[model samples]
Target: MIATSVEQLLNNLEGTVQVKADRVSVIDSRSLQLKVDSIVYNAVFAEGLVRDTARWLLWELGQQLGIYPSSIHEFYMAAGRGELPKSCTVPAINVRAMNFNTSRAVFRAANELSVGALIFEIARSEMGYTDQRPTEYVSSILGAAIKEGFRGPLFIQGDHFQVSAKGFAADPGAEVNAVKDLITESISAGFYNIDIDTSTLVDLSFDSLDDQQRNNYRVCADITRFVRQIEPEGITISLGGEIGEVGGHNSTVPELHAFMRGYNYKIGDLQG
Candidate 1:
């Protein structure tokens, strides 16, 4: 953790800095703040390079307040139960690049500007790019929210918790354990929404439809069980699964049904 004061951190944002996209130099924090206050910041926030640094600064400031990350499951459950109003969508932001900038923008907009669940996510590969451990990602997001004085619920998600078939085939134990470790580490970091991507595990060599889906659904079910076992009571983390790899093949209704059947058999009744 950095020993600098929030004021110091915020001050650091000041002064001339180069933005690579257009080679436009931000004059200082006040100038950048005004830019952020504009709609153009939305576009700027989408840029990976600029967004990462902006969030790093805000996160450093936010950590001082000791804020904890919120769960996305509650929001989804509320929406499903018709508690949330129609036409409501929460912004689930990828924190790898734009964590700080977009976070402060959302918080400021919601509290000050009449704007914007503000979900922060870090995928498995993203952990490497940003060199952020799961705990670090959680802390940074909560910290950024705290700095903005945004008291709304904060959702930190583990996006694309996946397994590649080649890797799994090489060493099934290692591959499965990698996913499990991610689940454990992410939960420890307060991630409540996990996307289990075992789509690559599909075995097309099998003639039976159910056989083709066996690996994907079974693996998803096993991981889901693991998540359920550790999840806090009254808080079911929102879980998701895919039927197939994105570029590999189109998913059919039969495949979907087969997956659900296998998943249910392994994990038990969804309603129960």
Candidate 2:
């Protein structure tokens, strides 16, 4: 059942349709067939009634944070086209929560500030609802945005789409397929930015740096191709690659060169 506050909040927001919330054992959120700005989003609330005042606070906060939906490709294209104003800066806020307190803060701040051209993303490793799968990350963000009365640019990003070395070594096929599946689902969920992190596969023991980044670049290229193939028409997803593992060694120019060379060779031609 939908909470009274949440129900009331949705009633105030335009473009909400068939808003539904059911009490369950855990927490989560999803978008329904609701349409706004030619994009569809449905709002689903978690189990148990949430009477949190943040719902109202978020709604109020949205007035200041106008929606700034943009993809990673948009940023790059602007820079490439030299359309960016001199000394322009973009603030990316990390909304690490799905339905809890942290997300509430993000909604409040973004809405209150009326910030433009902001980015919202969560790394694959830091997600809270691990059981819900990665795609739900976007759904929850949409739900939160709807709760806050946001109706503009909402850029969902897949930060650190990664492969674990141990997992890969044990079952390369499964691990590779899993990453591919994530790209598919993330794109379907309207995630416009994907960071392919195969740094864990970097074979530092290899005598040649090029050899070390073979796995990293190859996998990144594979995923990039997959993303390119399935991406919605007229839009290019921002794709990023990591050359060095975090907490290990700092990345160097050689590693970057090796990765880009391999990636270009694998994907054939880079579009935009």
Candidate 3:
């Protein structure tokens, strides 16, 4: 049954989950799937406070059940350091619509294949049109995981947390702050991976590659610092930097070098 209120939700979850004064305990693991399915449905489709409560309960339940939101940064770092052999490409799936069903299908497939390195992401643009905020997005994914009995780290990401070139050009502080605000919201909502797409600010009009990527790297560095400062104590958010805009000219080695040189120099003393 779709829960219409927090009271009804707890009542519906009675046989499967036990709630006692802020503590949630699982009583019947076998029946959890259906109950969680209802919770997620309500989390996504219910109105206002009902939706909020469902999402909050789902998050708490996931944590109690050993399904934690995590970062893929260390995994990628290992691959980059050559400590890991190239085995597979981890897919970052964007659930643009029907987030609940799509994510549920993803968990089902991953369970069948024993895959644990996939990501469920939502871009900044997608968030606007899809009307799925970071909290709702995360809840849908976690709820799917719970329904599937998938116990592990959930890599939810804020994909393409991009800076708008026009907005940045018009008012730099406001645009930068906008992206930072989204980052803060996403992180708070259990998004441990973030792709900062500042490549839109890259100016090809400049003669040198460094000059071209100057604004991009400078803004990226500033945002990176903000992310570092606000991230959870133990979790290091996996951050991606873009050197070129999508559909733009192919990125050359010089462009990558330039972006990295500027980004690293600007990001000095900040641990990634």
Candidate 4:
């Protein structure tokens, strides 16, 4: 989508501006309750300001600062008393972010100290997601990785956030609520993608007359609809429905297709 050559589009944020957390002073000279001097810029890729200007920033950063989140994942967060979108720069995707290796080489040459002109690609580290620890692991990794990159494109993935037996055993509704909270925090942390894996709850034993499995299936369908209904625009977020085992050895193509068709999702649904 960039009109100019990739070589000429490396921008560095470190040189143009500096970020000082201690200098975070919320100015409110207005007589009103809120700060009347609020000004939101379109620089989504800037260090601290929350905006939806990633691609242009990516172009500018690559042209100026030299690094950007690879996926353009739109960000989300819960501020004050409500759930809100913090930044819309990053986009969302349906497929797993790690699946990029299937299309291109996972490794790329890095020049962390080139100091001026350079290039880079999406460098992702798994956020250590098991059923135990939550979103912070991945958020920390993403933040660190973004700082590690010299230029071009650098990004972090929220990987997969799902319902775990351990988390849910405490309470079914609690697991859902916790997952939502994690998602909110991760989006605020500047992760490019949020993979909501509800596949674990689906009842594969639907062939049987099990009520529990049937309930689980309903939950998966419900969650799928929720994601499609609420995800931010241009944020490449993917809601992977439970269409049989995604990592099983015995699931055949026909079975997978049938499972997907049953849920109204196609066999070869292509999403970026």
The lDDT leader among the candidates is 3
For each candidate in the order shown, give its overall lDDT on alpha carbons: 0.67, 0.62, 0.90, 0.37
User: Candidate 3 at residue 134, lDDT?
Assistant: 94
Q: Per-residue lDDT tens digits of candidate 3, residues 1-272?
A: 56667899888887888888888888887798867888888888898888888888888889888998999999999889988868767998999898888888998999999997899999999999999999999998888888888899999999999999999999999999999999999999999999999999999999999999999999999999999999999999999989999885899999999999999999987864
Off by over 4 Å in 3: none
Model 2 whole-model lDDT (C-alpha atoms): 0.62
Query: What RMSD does each model have against the real structure?
Result: 9.5, 8.2, 1.2, 15.4
| Best TM-score among the predictions, by candidate number | 3
**Which one wins by TM-score: 2 or 4?**
2
Q: Is candidate 3 or candidate 4 better by TM-score?
A: 3
Q: Write candidate 2's Cα lDDT for 166-262 as tens digits.
A: 9999998899788888778767656788888888999988899889989988887777877888888887888888889878768889789988888
Deviation from native of the Cα of residue 104 in model 3, angstroms = 1.4
Q: Report how far off residue 229 is in candidate 3 (Å).
A: 0.5
Q: What is the lDDT of residue 107 in candidate 2?
A: 65
- The residue ranges of model 4 lying beyond 4 angstroms of the native Cα positions read 1-66, 70-149, 166-170, 208-217, 224-233, 241-249, 265-272
Compute the lDDT of residue 9 as modeled in candidate 1: 31
Candidate 4 per-residue C-alpha lDDT over 132-250 given as tens digits, one digit per residue, 9 for 90 to 100: 12222332222222333333444444455666656666788887776666666554444445555555565555664233234344445545554444455665553333334357445
